[model samples]
Structures are given as C-alpha cells and as structure tokens.
Target: MNWNRYIKDYQSYLRIERGLSKNTIENYGFDIERLCLFLEVNQIDVSPLKITDETLQQFIYEIAKEVNPRSQARIISGLKSFFNYLIFEDYRNDNPLELIESPKTGRKLPDTLSVEEIDSLIAVIDLSSNEGERNRAMIETLYGCGLRVSELITLKISDLFFEEGFIKITGKGNKERFVPIGKFAQRYIEIYQKEIRSNLVIKKGFEDTLFLNRRGSQLTRAMIFTIIKSLAEKVGLHKNISPHTLRHSFATHLLENGADLRSIQLMLGHESITTTEIYVHLDRSFLKEVMYSFHPRK
Candidate 1:
C-alpha cells in the first residue's frame, strides 16, 4: 500500500481501536511521514508494508544526528507502533521495529507546584473581568480533580454529579472515571455557570461544554497553557509550569497528605500503578517526618 493510504488506516486504528488523542495520532502520523520522506530522498522505493528492519534502522540512524536521544527514541517508538499496527492487521508478516532499541535514559519525573505556589497563582486572577469567574472555576477543577487539560476543556455540565459528590472525568482514550469533587471546586463552577455563563450564548457544538471561551467555543489546549503561563509570570514563580504541573501537584499533594498510592492512582486515571508511584518519591521526606514524630521505634 502507498504511504498515504497506510497512514490513514493507521490513524483510524489509533483513534477507534487504541483510543489515542488527536495530537498523539498526529505525532505517530508525522513519524511515519518523516520515514517515508527519508526513504524517498535516499532513492529507496520500498513502501511501508515492504520496509525491512534493516532499512528502518538505517533511517533511525540518519535522523539521530538531528534529534536528541530522548526525542530520537520517541520517534523510534512512534514508528514501531505504526509497523505493529500493520502486523496486527496481517498486512505484514513481520514488524520492522521489533528489534529496534530505545536509547537508555533516566526516568524523568513530572514537575509539581507547591500548595502555596498554587494559591499565589490563583490569587492573581483579576476577578473583575467577565471570563475571570470561568477561569477561576477552570483552574480549580484542573488542580482539584487531577484532570488532564483535554479532560478539563471537554468537561460538560452533565458530567457534574454534585449530588453524588463526584464529577465524571473523561480521560485519555475516552475512558471515564468518576472523581470526587471538592466543595471549593463545585462552588466556583456553580458561580461561573449561574452568574456568568448563563447569560452568554454558548456556541452550538459546545453548548453543553462547561468551560467556554469568549467566543463560546470549547477551550483549546493552547489556551490552557496560555492561562497557566500568564498566571505563572504574574505570580513571579520561577517554575516551568504547565497544566500538567497542576495535575502532578494534585497527585503529589495527596500523597504527601498520607493518601495511599493506589487511591491516588485511581483518582488520576493511571492504567498502571507504576505511573502513580513516581509521585511517591516526592513524599519521602514527609514519610520520614511522620516516622520520626509518630513511630515509637524511631
């Protein structure tokens, strides 16, 4: 099959079968496209289905000069998934990336915000603006519920189960998890909806969407990053903070407060407990402090 047709099918598989996000699927497609471009440039006429492991390895080696080890490794991984999909569908007898090795790198932990830093960031929001109430509610839900930015923007009014004390969060791959909502978060959202949002004409497709931009459309990931970055600058906090920082902080703060890893894992919608265990590292000092204060053996 041609590279274009194969990539189209691969994207469909990622979306429908694997439940990957649009950005993730697009990245995978870009990796495959880059590989195809490299092969064409080098006068190699082999299609994706006919690509051999050796040729794939050569392509990776060529690209390694331009990218860092970590980024090169990610590209390799994305290519591997593309080939694996072909093998799974019986279009190929073998996987080209089966023997390819990912470069060895140290486990990089996600950055987190301190509770005081979070408060300081939120404190600077100019509540007098029309979108200020909405912004306040958005940040609270993001940090309080440990939501991915995608989950936060796509959040709907129907997702709020306030009477049940839970908000249903749609996570990666469209998986749904009911996370308990704090009263603080619920209160702000209510104020935004009833006081601010009720009067605006929400855009058609996003009418049920909880957070709307001034244009009444769903908030984009860029907007979320913009919101956080602007806030961080205003607060003069010298951390390279992102929306995910709030998420990591939510998990880390909970772990520091003596919440078990398993409970944090469930709330964060981690498919693997190992993913949640990274935050456990941040709580070590707190653990030792508790041991020294409360443990008789200490």
Candidate 2:
C-alpha cells in the first residue's frame, strides 16, 4: 500500500486499538509525513513497505542536523513504531530501524520550585481581579495534585470526590486515575466556583467542566501556560517555569517530605515506577533522610 493508506491505517490502529490521545497520534503522523516529504523532495519512489534502511538512515541524518539529540531520538522512535506496526500486520518481515540505535540522550532532571517559592508565587495574585480566584485555584490544583496541564484543563466538576479526598484525572492514553486533592486546593476551588464560575453564562456542552475562561468555555492548555508565565513575571521569579514545573515541584516536594516513590507514582498517575524514580535524583538529601529514618542500622 501507499504511504497515505498505510498512515491512515496506523492512525486508526492507534486510536481504536491502542487508545492513544489525539495529540500523540498527531505527533506520530507528523513524523511519518516528514519522511514522505523528504522522499518526495528527493524524487525517491518507494512505499512504506518497500522503503530501505539506507533511506531511513538518510532521513535520520537529515533530521539530526535540524533538531536536538532528544528530538532526533524521538523521531527515530516514532519511525520505529510505524515500521513495527507494519511487521505486526505481516506486511513486512523486518523493521527498517531494527539495526538502528537511538542517540545517547541522557535523562533530563525536572526543575522544581521550593515550598517558599511556591507560596510566594501564589501570594502575588491580584485577588480583586475577576479571574484571581480561578487562577489561584488552578495553580493550587496543578501543584497539589501533580497534574499535567492537559489533565488540569480537562478536569470536570463531577470528578471531584471531596468526601473521598480525590479527583478523577484522565491522563495519557485515555487512562483514568483518582488523585488526592488537598484541602488547600479544594478550598480555593470552592471559593472560585461560588463567587466567580457560578455566575458565568457557560456555553453549551461544557457544563461539567471545572474551570472556565471569562468567555465561559473550557480553558486551552496554552492559556494555562500563559497564566503561569505571567504570574512568574509578576513575582519576579528567575527560573524558567511552566505548568509542568509545578508538577515537577509537586513530585519533588513529596519525595522530600517523606513520601514514598510508589505513593507519588500513584498520585502522578505514572504508568511506570521508573518514571517516578527520577525524583530520587532531585534531592540526594532525601535519600539520606529516608535511610536514617527507616533503616535498622541508622
């Protein structure tokens, strides 16, 4: 089959069988399209099932010049997945990337904010503004629940099980997890709902959404980043921070405060304990503290 037909099938498989999120499917599609564009520009006539490893090596070589090692590695991985899918369907006997190796891109340690820094950032909010309480609640929930920006935006009011001290979060791959909600975040959310959101003329089909823009609709992920960036500037914070920074801070702070990685893994909805173990590197002191507190010889 041609590239278009193959990609369409792959997209369908990812959506229907794998249950990948739209953004993830788009990213995978982009990688395939880039390869197609490269082949077209070079006048190379080869289909996905017929493409050679040499051609793929050429594509990787081309992208290595344009992107960083991390991005280049990801593109290689995405391409590998596509070829593997072909093999799974018995369209190919071997993957073009079978012998290829991803670059040695080291793991990036996530940046985290100190507890004082978090408090200071929240303290600078202009409480008199119409969105002040809403913004405050959003940040609190982001940090308190260790939520990804996507999770924070898609959060629904009906998901809040305050009596159970949890809020249901739909994470990557459409998987759902119930994360604990601190009283600190719950209180601010309640205040915003009662004083601000309760009065909005909300648009159709977004009635269950927890956070709304001034236009009375769901907030975009970019808008959440803009709010956090503006707040950082207002507080004169020096670090380059994003919504994910709060998430990293949440995990790191939990590790430092005597919480186990397993617990943090569950709260952050990490599918792998290894993903949650990165916080162990953030604070070496936490290791010593854990050793002394729980070890028999300490």
Candidate 3:
C-alpha cells in the first residue's frame, strides 16, 4: 500500500483498537510522515512493507544530525511500533528496526514548584478582572487534582462530584480514574461557577465544559500554558514553570507530606508505579526525613 493508505490504517488502529489520544496518534503519524518525506526527497521508491533496514538506518542517521537524542529516540520508538504493527497484521516478515538501538537518554525528572511558590503565583492573579475567578479556579483544579493540561481543559461540570469528594478524569488512552478534589479547589471552583460561569452565555457544544474562555468555549491547551507563564512572570518566580509544573508539584508535595507512591500514582493517573517513582528522586530531603522517621539506625 501507499504511505498515505498505511498511515490512515495505522491511525484508525490507534484510535479504535489502541484507544490512544488524538495528540498521541498525531505524534505517531508525524514520525512515520518524516520517514516518508525523507524517502520522497531522496527519490527512493519503497512501500511500508518493502522498506529495508538500510533505508531506515539512513533516515535515522539523517535525523540524528538534526535532532537531539531524546527526539531521535522517540522517532526510533515510534517507527519500531509502526513496524511491529505491520508484523502483527502479517504485512511484513521481519521488523526493519529490530536491530536498531535507541540512544541511552537518562530519565529526566519533571520540574516542580514549592508550596510557597504556588501560593505566591496564585496570589498574583488580578481578582478585579472578569477572568480572575475562573483563572484561580483553573489553577487550583490543576494542582489539586494533579491533572494534565488536556484533562483540565476538557473537564466538565458534570464530572464534578463535590458531594462524593471526587472528580472523574479521562486520562491517556481514554482511561477513567476518579481523583479526590481538595476542599480548597472545590471552593474556588464553586465560587467561579456561582459568580462568573453561571452568568456567561456558554457556547452550544461547551455547555458542559468546566473552564470557559471569555468567548464562552472550552479553553485551549496553549491558552492554559500562556496563563501559567504570565502568572509566573507576575510573581517574579523564575523557574520556567508550565501547567505541568503544578502537576509535578502536586505529586511531589503529596509524597513529601507522607503519601505513598501507589496513592500518588492513582491520583496522577499513571499507568504504572514505575512512572510515579521519579518523584522519589526529586526530593532527597524527603527521603532523608523518611529514613530518619522509620529506619532503626536513625
């Protein structure tokens, strides 16, 4: 099949069978598209089933010169998955990337904000503005629930279960998890809903959406990043913070406060405990405290 046809099928498989999110599916497609672009630019004629390991290695060599090791590893991983899918479907006899080794990039820890830094950032919000209450509620929800930016934007009013003290989250691969929402976050959200959102003329499709722009639609992921970046600047904090900084802080702070990794993992919607273990490395002081509190030698 042609590259476009193979890509279309792969995308459908990801969405239907694998249940990956749109952004993830797009990323996977982009990796394959880069390979296709390389083939076209070099006038190399080969189908997905016919592409040889030498051609893929050449593509990898070209990309390695232009991209960092992390990006190179991602592209390699994406290609490997694509070829594996082809093998699963009986389109290929062997994988082209079977022998290709990914660069050994160490696990990068996520940047987190301190509790005081979080407070200072929130305190800088202009409460006089029309969006002040909404922004405050958004930030609280982000940190309190440990949500991804995508999850924060797509959060709905109906998803809030204040009486039950939980908020339902649709995480990666459409996996659903119920995370406990703190009273502080719930209070801010209630204030915004009662005072601001209740009066707005929400758009047709966004009636159920929790966070709305001044235009009365769901907020975009970029808009969330811009909001957080502007707040960080206003607070004079120079940590290169993003919406995810709040999420990392949420998990880190919880661990520091005596929460277990399994509990943090569930709240953050991490698929594996290993993904949650990075927080253990973030705070050496916390580890020292834990050892002193529990170890016999201490």
All candidates' TM-scores? 0.65, 0.66, 0.66
Candidate 1 global Cα RMSD = 12.0
Per-prediction tally of clashes: 0, 0, 0
What is the model-wide C-alpha lDDT for candidate 2?
A: 0.86
Model 2, 284: alpha-carbon shift in Å? 2.9
lDDT (10s digit) by residue, model 3, range 134-168? 99999999999999888999998999999999999
Q: Write the per-residue lDDT of candidate 2 for residues 1-298, one digit (tens) a residue.
A: 2799999999999999999999999999999999999899978888898886656766776777798889887888999999999999999987877656677664334457899999988999898986899999999999999998889999999999999999999987589999999999999999999999999999999999999999899999889989999999988888878887898899888878778789998998775565466433455676787889889999
| Candidates in descending TM-score order | 3, 2, 1
CA displacement after TM-score superposition, residue 263 of candidate 2 (Å): 1.1
> Per-residue CA lDDT of candidate 1, range 1-298, in tens?
3789989999999999989999999999899889888888978888887776546656766776688878888998898888788889999976767645677553234467889999988899989987889889999999999987879999999999999999998876578899999998999999999988898888888889999988888989889999999999999988878887898899988977778888998998876565466533455578789899889999
CA lDDT scores, all candidates in order: 0.83, 0.86, 0.86
Model 3 lowest lDDT segment of ten: 274-283
Enumerate residue pairs that collide in model 1.
none
